[model samples]
Target: MKKVTLKKNLSAAMISLLALSSFGGTVHGESKTGINADAAILVNAETGKIVDKYNEDQPLGVASMTKMMTEYLVLEAIDKGKIEWTDTYKISDKVYQLANAPGLSNVPLRAGDAYTIKELYEAMVIKSGNGAAIALSEAVAGSEGEFVKRMNAKAAQLGMEHYKFVNSSGLSNYDMLGMHPEGTGVNDENMVSAEDMATLAYRLIKDYPEVLKTSGTNYKYFRKGTDEEYLMKNTNALLKDRAYSYKGADGLKTGTTPFAGSTFTGTAERDGVRYITVILDAKDQYGQPSSAERFIQAAKMLDYGFTQYETVQYTLDDTETKDALPVQDGKEAEVKITVDKPIKVRMMKKEIKQAGVELKLDKDKTGEDGKLQAPVEKGEKIGELVLKNEKEAEYILDGLQRDQKVNVYASSTVEKANWFVRSARNIGEFLKDIFG
Candidate 1:
């Protein structure tokens, strides 16, 4: 894998993108409401920005939604040539034993049974089959533990600071004989934050869209050998029930464990706009509907986001070069930089000009000239510009500070040479020209 880095500095274009007044006009200051879930969040799927949040940072158990990450790694393995959809895998004893074990969702695989990767994938995703999860993990990473390592590593790469995985099947914690079994601690399962769940959902839908092939299916049948066949049903009821009228509701994972309660990662697209919502630990005190309650809360949050916000682009012209700072001992003393593309902000028409932009530069490494130099690879940053409105300022800053900074970068190359070498080379050129 190749490493790519970005440097930004946005001091000059502080009020470039934020339309504070626009949002203030549209967003009527409504009273804050509480939901039944322990944690919940709604995010713009395209920008990965949090539109609404509650306890988003707190880590909580994510039930079968853990399968979403499992699905992601499986798809990644297929892309990397480690496995293929048509590849066949033999069911190991360990996997079969786990599948047959009491109190776990499974696809009912027998030891020594063989199934294709595509078949098992459907079982894992649509049926929430724990056996298939284990089988696929073993096929890809040679062991479930190793596959989990990859999962955690991928989470870290995506900035999921509060997530950990102990099993691929998400069946780590179970009560044996009404008492927590010895060595089967409560901490053995997967734990994640609402923000992290959203991040993972975004990656799954954005990067590995092919996984949805099976997840969206309402039912699938697996043929084991010529005489044996079993029908698997989707655990998610939204596909079956149309009354909810969830527009563009599509394939995603759901999870429920005794310890984890109920968890869901749902995605919906309307009029070309997509959104992902996550809810964890949603259970009713009485017999009231918990999943439905969480879904309603998510729908409300999403509606608020889509109705009130839009992504708008603001261009910082290359002609706006007055912000460039002076460089020492370089061919070009200064260079101009501007925003590469228009940015999208959620606001109304009245607040467009009030947005703030902040730019941040990468590490300022000195060059070979022995002067303070920038690694001025074209578009290297001079500083950052932040765009904020009155509300953002009030929250980000102590009071109503409107001005913010956006990043500036070098538009052209700046060449530097050692003093002794440059002096000698200039003399040699003069002598050659005059003597000739």
Candidate 2:
């Protein structure tokens, strides 16, 4: 049986979930709340904030959504130059056999048949072709087992502690005893948490925007030989029409199995903001539309995000500067410190007045003289600025800390202070100290 591993990395925003016991605040109810799947998560693609969640950290059979990881690994290979769009891969017997396997999605490649890496990627993502995934794995790593090692390793690297992979095709069934009574362990499947799936989806699109170009394609055709051409349609019906369209609802992966249920990683972008939603065990039967329920949940969460929260730049304006620190043994007497950017937070319009900034400094670095020494670089750490509101104490804070020792680099004349001049100055200082 195949084995696989995966991990999750929470962004600072999502890390805030640790502070809240639940994300159901304000948003409630079975129908209105964004919790339609057995496991679901809606996170800000850019900020990684948990907008809504239901059994998000719970591990469940993810079915074809396992292909999201496969897609991730493939894009990584392409980004790192291990594979290229134009590169051709020779079909192997293993992949060919899997392609012909009943109930498996495949691109129908025969042994010795070749297709470009780009074409295989489209088949895997657009058509949900398991055989295409196996072929790509072999092409990049020489064997399905070895590629799976890479998959698990990558998962660990991504901090997805709850995931494990058994095969490139996600067909392993080692843990399906309760779900499948036929005693078939051969269908070794890939597993991951809803949070981990969202993490993978975010990273894939953020790192390899090109994958979207292929995943968003609604249809494609590949020729295996002069006489045979396989016309493939995208398995994601959501992409078929404009009726249920959501802006930036681009390419992503979906999956289903009798044991795993319906699962999907759906990504959408609007007004420069991107969001990733993961739903696991969303359906009661195969080839069903239960995954769409999660999409509705995602839309609600995203709408709330855009309308309820606002990102503000809080850079230190000159008008806000209370005072400048003096510089000793430097051409300039002082330097200005300011906030880098405005922070974003969710709040009601009436609560805007409650937002304020607090500045602090490193106590050890600040001298009693209240002046910085020479050789200060531009944009050097001088102080930290924290932004907070009444409801949430602190929403965002810049890394810069107060009293952080800053250099005051000498100007043109000071730059000419050579070793002799420095030594002469040191000798004069020593003589003055002894006399005193």
Candidate 3:
């Protein structure tokens, strides 16, 4: 297996195919965003831009939503050849008991019977099975205790600011029935802020998109054709045919615990844009815990994202780059530069028309006088040109203008000037200085 490195961000073009082909590119009117939740956030998955947010940074229990990180590590291990989907793990008595425990979300695991990693992964993702999660954790890291360490390490590596992973599953230690990972408090539950949840979701999709194949399924049978056959339905209610089904809704996780309430991380694609949303500890209008409440909150945010934003090609306008760079001792006195590639950004439809580009040249490539040295090659790297909207404030993470950026490159090669021509130019400059 090839090693996979975590990518900080993905280009919109990479997932553009998920967009609807029928979209006519018209921007929809903005809608009011009034979300009732302890914390909520809407993010443009491609650009990692925060579209709508409320109390996004407040850390709160994530309940089973914490399994997303577990899912990520399992996928990472597979990618790194540490494990295979075909690898089978024998069911231990502890895992079998946990799987059979009353009132917990789980699929039956027979003691002394071996189940493939793929089988357990499906159980964990589609059914939010606590037992399956612990089993997979042990398979990957030898024990839930060691796996919890890996979970926290991966969270820190991913830049999650407010988060703690006490166990492989998101269950509070009390829910673990004294089988919680060693060193964790009895009632400690997985905790994370809405913003960080979005980050984790984004990385999971970006890294192991194949996980969606299982998570998106409405239902599947575990241990099919056998006496132990059990049907596992995806917990993400927003999937097709579910009670709160929404178009383009697919793959993500839902969580609920006495402490966490109802929480969801949802994603949808439309018109060449995808948005990831998180609604944590949501309540219905009556301010009561309801499974449907998180879906409703997620729908509101998804609706706002789909209707209020537009993805369009961001190119250098015809009049933006007429200026040329002076080249010292080159065949030509100046070299023209242009954008190296096409850039796309998801922005509020109302603000698209107000966007402008700013050119930034690389200082290292040029001389003290801010001129390129001769022998410049066509398409040579120079610097990046940033797209900015004067009307918009930097609302996402700092330095992440979410502005479309493309490298600027030399449009044509400029050969070095001949010795005679160089001498004549130098002499002319010296004479002019003496005369002055």
Per-residue alpha-carbon lDDT of candidate 3 for residues 292-352, written as tens digits (9 for 90 to 100): 8899989999999998887756554623554477788899998888875666766678887
In terms of lDDT, the poorest run of 10 residues in model 2 is: 394-403
lDDT of 3 at 337: 82
Clash statistics: count for each candidate: 42, 36, 0
Task: Give TM per candidate.
Answer: 0.65, 0.71, 0.84
TM-score, model 2 to reference: 0.71
> For model 1, how does the per-residue alpha-carbon lDDT over 196-238 read when each residue is reduced to its tens digit?
8988887788798876667767777777454557788776654
lDDT of 2 by residue, 193-223 (tens): 7777887776777777887777777777766
Query: Which runs of model 1 end up more than 4 angstroms from their true locations?
Result: 1-33, 175-187, 224-228, 240-245, 285-289, 313-341, 348-436
Q: Residue 258: error of model 3 in Å? A: 1.1
Task: Output candidate 1 Cα RMSD.
Answer: 14.4
Ranking by TM-score: 3, 2, 1
lDDT of each: 0.65, 0.62, 0.81
